[model samples]
Target: MTFFLPFSTVARLRFGSASRIHIFALYRWNY
Candidate 1:
């Protein structure tokens, strides 16, 4: 999910602090 999205776009969405953490975790997992 997060792997398919660009970090800039994710940041712009501002899903929330918790979502940000989840997305960041996904990003780390993806890499």
Candidate 2:
């Protein structure tokens, strides 16, 4: 059997710590 979910990303995005913010900032800068 296989299972998948999408909300994990949102949860991580909202609840994620400084690392996510740093990465996201880097991503935004790269764009």
Instruction: Highest TM-score: give the candidate number.
Output: 1
| Best model number under lDDT | 1
* Over 4 Å off, model 1: 1-15
Model 2 CA RMSD to the hidden true structure, in angstroms: 7.1
Ten residues in sequence with the least summed lDDT for candidate 1: 3-12
Q: Once model 1 is optimally superposed onto the true structure by TM-score, how far is the C-alpha of residue 18 displaced, in angstroms? A: 0.3
Each prediction's Cα lDDT score?
Answer: 0.81, 0.73
Residue-by-residue lDDT tens digits, candidate 1, 1-31: 6766787677667767768899999999999
Cα distance off (Å), candidate 2, residue 10: 21
TM-score of 1: 0.49
List candidate 2 stretches off by more than 4 Å: 1-16
Residue 8 in candidate 2 has what lDDT?
69
lDDT of 1 at 17: 74
